[model samples]
Target: MYTNSVLQTDYPWTKTPLVASAPMLNIAMAPLAVSVSAAGGLGFLAGGFDVSALESNLEEAVHLIKQSSAPIQETYASTAVLPIGVGFLNWGADLPKSIAAIEKYRPCAAWLFGPRSIPDDLRPWVEQVRAVTEGKTKIWVQVGTVAEAVAVAEALNPDVLVVQGADAGGHGLAQSASVITLVPEVKDVLTTRQVKNDIPLLAAGGIVDGRGMAASLALGASGVAMGTRFLASSEAKIARGYQDEVLRVSDGGSNTSRSKVYDRARGILSWPVQYDGRGVINKSYIDSAEGGMSDEENRALYKEELKKGDLGWGPNGRLTTYAGTGVGLVKTKLPAGEIITNMIQEAKAILQQLKA
Candidate 1:
């Protein structure tokens, strides 16, 4: 078989276009997931926030998937095994709720992000879910670096691996390796370790189109997971204003800063020592404190900004706008399915042209 680069190998995954959207709270992640799956890709409903929201989103996502499948529509039936997944913040919010959710939903896959390694307790959680789902469900863990990925892979024994680069939008590894630089390195590491599980390696952060998809796969990634690009889609749950900001921002996007400002104000208890989130630089959030203000001060400023409706100050503004470096590439909001389909088609074209 011909290969472009990165010593391409046939893995368990069929080398398809895979896009995973960040599960936003209150907003429906299911519709977005279903839309992407309907377009012949995968979708994951985010579930790590308030316990209520998590439960609600899971139930609603299942309901939507079932209802949308009514009448044996060819469209729905055609994509029945679209590889839908669900994700949760590993070190944020209530882990119990997330655990219970996996058992209840039994999604095709479960993704966990944050923390360098999967805690001992999480092993049981993973095992329980795997057992409850009768081993049909796969487990995916997201990490920032090659070392972190290896550590988690060894500890968790997840069915798949997701290496999220620093450019990934939302809360990710602070100041870590870029995805372009890390994918092949991680791939080499996995191969060296004598692990032949054929785990699908997913490249995240700053991937938007066929060019990016081809680049990542060529670099030893089995697939690509995109968040920001999908968030701008019509099926996404974000407000129009939020999506507009995402498109307006540049690729670098004013040096995205990660901090605990928003989580504290929202009263969402995240691990103080473990992780922070990256969001766009909002004027009001910057005004709350001098450059050196304490995290608490920033939280107060976030709260104050929440009170003022003007300046577009709110969660969409004061809170971090989770986006990847590819934000610059996102120009318009299209349906999630169209975006996924186009990227896959474009990638195939690029690869075919390269073969010729």
Candidate 2:
């Protein structure tokens, strides 16, 4: 099993049972990332499919971190590396710009995901990032299956492995097991293969609160990475209607389904065939899956919805509301820092009670 000590050594200021915000493209921006890190957890800013804004985003994050409290500033005063992390979608990210931003800003971690090909597509990214940062920026790869975990571990040897289950939001493998089975299985396989045991595993998917965090820790994860839970954070770069819908949904298991309908409707077809997104089931999904709505028709409707702004999202709205199965657990919009601290405290209480 993995332990939080591994993460603590890499991120000296982080607290135990590490809570990290998943870099939900465009949503997890500078404020959210900085706030989470300031609260003694890891926060990540999405580098997005395009790397054009990455440098500016990092600059803003740097400014925010400097303006942070004395403790946060002092902790990072000696290191040139930024405390926050940046996540990239390998399939569409421009390698040159991505490498340049990483080289310049040197965020504590670079989370690589959605590669068109395993190991092969990831090698240059891993090598170049390490070379430019001199290992200051840790490599964290998000994998959805045991095969990817093993392959990446054996070949790339990422500093951290984020095991994303099928229940996760945004983009991930269309067919993958839940974190309950995936985390332990990956650990067992890596151990049996004599891979580096010190590499920590971060569980992602359907983890919203302390209960979920405690359960993940018990399942052999050193930490938890939450995307959906952070969607409700006040710092999240989300629209009013989208956030409201995130709070309105319940029984995540029934309300959210994995499909490419939303992506197609939004005109984003660059993702690999095996990958799909999990989001709230809305008219857009229903129209395509059941109503037999043509792709062109759905795309046209989605365009109109975009003009409606906040009104564009909801059960009947045509806009995309990508979220995880644990969306129900996120009821209110709170500061990213509060969410981090509260979850850590809640997890601690639950663990102590369990021991008792």
Candidate 3:
């Protein structure tokens, strides 16, 4: 039986980061999130866009969960069911609409990101969701530094603290602490601050597999949060070319830098200055960074990249290849359910051997 307490919740425990993936967007692959939950990991629906999409995904997830339960029942023999959660990029998505959707669907939790203060301007919104959820909904805030983690933990006491490293793909703090160094430090702080032990600690950024999961547990994290790995999975929404790039690119291939070039082009204006995005280095990106190109030229370049394919879709260099350092470990995209099962099995294998 899965011992993860969050699994006991009626809601989903989001198996992977729910954004920018190819398979996840597939309605057929939607069962993957529920599969992760059945395996004792939470699966999150990516709700970074708007209310309608959020509602659609939530409804779809619920449908999939119901749809997948027969197989789970056969396998678990009356065990508690797995939970499914939803993710919203606080920096880009609309909070109210997302919150409303959560209130209506009532997911297991809400994962929020963007470099800003924890217990941020969204506290009331979070509280409102909690009220609607009757305390069923949790808040998993992603942070890059011990200070930020500590701050957020102290203020909101979110259900989970996702400690993201600088190596994490997507948007993250411009210069932040590495996950290896920060997890233990945050664990100590949680102790000194007298936070509840059951409050889970999740380590993100560059985590790829069972080895990474083992490492996170050793570092005092209850579990690991993976984005890049899922992005490469068959259920994600990325282009085939993009998935190939993630696999072919070495772990060091994530040397991709962070910047707001894409944010500007995408028209998401409210992101804080402390953070930037990581993406593949490309010509449009290079041209955007140079400042030599006129606005017309830059826009044209951005459009050109988009036309080239999904690889160049975000902004100039800002195309949405949000992968972490773990991309190197990824050899191919698999079903999200298979990925979770394999990760746990491999970690358990290694951990059992270590006890010997």
TM values, all candidates: 0.84, 0.98, 0.83
Model 3, span 259-354: residue lDDT tens: 666555555567688877766555545666765554466666666666667555432343456567777788977877678778878888878898
lDDT-best of 2 and 3: 2
lDDT of 1 by residue, 246-329 (tens): 777774545455655545555566553556566666643465433555667666666776554444532346655666778778
Listed per candidate, the RMSD to the true structure in angstroms reads: 4.4, 1.1, 4.5
Candidate 1 minimal-lDDT segment of 10 residues = 4-13
Candidate 3, residue 115: how far the Cα is off, in Å: 6.7
Q: For residues 1-356, could you state the per-residue lDDT of candidate 2 as single tens digits?
A: 32567687789878888989999887999999999899888999999789899999999998999999555577668887899999999998998899999999989999999998865558899999999999999999999999999999998989999999999998999999999999999989999998887579999999999998999988889999999998999899988899999999999999999999989999999998999999999989999999999999999999999999999898989888999999978898899888888898898898889889
Q: How far is candidate 1 from the true structure (C-alpha RMSD, Å)?
A: 4.4
Compute the lDDT for candidate 1.
Answer: 0.66
Local distance difference test, each candidate? 0.66, 0.91, 0.65
Ranking by TM-score: 2, 1, 3
TM value for model 3? 0.83
Please list the residue runs of candidate 1 whose C-alpha ends up more than 4 Å from where it truly belongs after superposition: 1-15, 24-28, 67-83, 93-96, 253-255, 260-269, 272-274, 284-290, 308-317
Clashing pairs in 1: 169-323
Candidate with best TM-score: 2
Model 2 bad stretches (over 4 Å): 1-3
